[model samples]
Target: MKDGGINFISFSVGRYGVLKTFSEQDMESLLAAYLKEHPDALERMHFVMLHPFRDDDDEMSRSAREIHHVAKRMKFFQDYVARNPYDSTILINNPTPRSKLYLDFVHYVAALLGPIGSYEIFK
Candidate 1:
């Protein structure tokens, strides 16, 4: 539901291991098809893209590539918003557990999203 111009779209990408290429046309097509099948989707049509990130030395090496990928996705959504300007927010979650408790990826994601002010830190 939309309130004060903010619209939330919630979706989950299951762990099937097939990397799908994301593009503006692809997103539009997906939304169109989804709306056709489930009309209610049209009401909360903001897009959220979720993908896994594995921590490896190679992952650090590909920082530039990931930056480009994010830029392209942002541009695609920006263009979509231009045609249909609506308040939208993107919430990305990793949904993958770390092998070791020391590797708190959730904290990293939260920091990237912005301040989590005064949230209790538990051990």
Candidate 2:
């Protein structure tokens, strides 16, 4: 389907609290490959960063550790994106239990990707 009026490219490169699952290098390589395939779509690319869900159990500890690693890795990602031949935006977020970040994230996708495309991406 046509992506509304704008050609929006949305990619989720990492999972919540899964630090080792995909390193920053892997994400950079993935984006590079994607850019090679869709050369004209880099200007509207949206890289969304999901907030890690922290529970009051063992998972909380894991989440803390993972977030620490992610904090460090994000700097490299930012540098690469800046030097690369693409105009993209990175949304960095830390969701608290009472925060409405999900709603904000949804709105961001809708605004950036358009209504029709946002629904598909939100799923």
Candidate 3:
């Protein structure tokens, strides 16, 4: 498939959420494709994680306990970090979210992820 004068596809890593289910090989293929398509992607690529906002516990959001399980298990995560050529900062989301503020933050991140008219977050 060719671009056909259309710009499509982008990837900026974030909390795995459902992606935690993806096998390491699957992730490798995805990153490989992204990098191949966007040689300059490292300049815009990112990986975000919330330290204490893990609402996944008690089934809240999947329990913050495993917030980084996938990244830790996957060696590719480390490779990305090591080869990152851009200057990206890690967001420090408040452990206790403030509604408006939290929503704003969510919106800001959604924009950075480059969603279309609408996008589904996670299952």
The candidate maximizing TM-score is 3
Displacement of residue 65 (Cα, Å) in model 1 is: 2.6
Ranking by lDDT: 3, 2, 1
Cα RMSD for candidates in order: 17.5, 15.9, 15.5
**What tens digits encode model 1's per-residue C-alpha lDDT throughout 9-93?**
3332332112122333434443344335555422221111121333344543343233333333445434544544332353354
Model 3, global lDDT: 0.35
Candidate 1: residue 56 Cα off by (Å) = 1.7
What is the per-residue lDDT of model 2 for residues 42-98, given as tens digits with 9 covering 90 to 100? 233332222124333454333334333343345544453443323235436533311
- What's the residue-level lDDT of 80 in candidate 2? 33
Q: If both were scored by TM-score, which would come out higher, candidate 1 or candidate 3? A: 3
User: Local error of candidate 2 at 44, Å?
Assistant: 1.8
Candidate 2, 11: how far from true, in Å? 18
Off by over 4 Å in 2: 1-20, 46-123
Please report the TM-score between candidate 2 and the true structure: 0.22
For candidate 3, report its TM-score.
Answer: 0.24
Kindly give the number of clashing pairs for every candidate.
0, 0, 5
Q: Per-residue lDDT for 86 in model 2?
A: 37
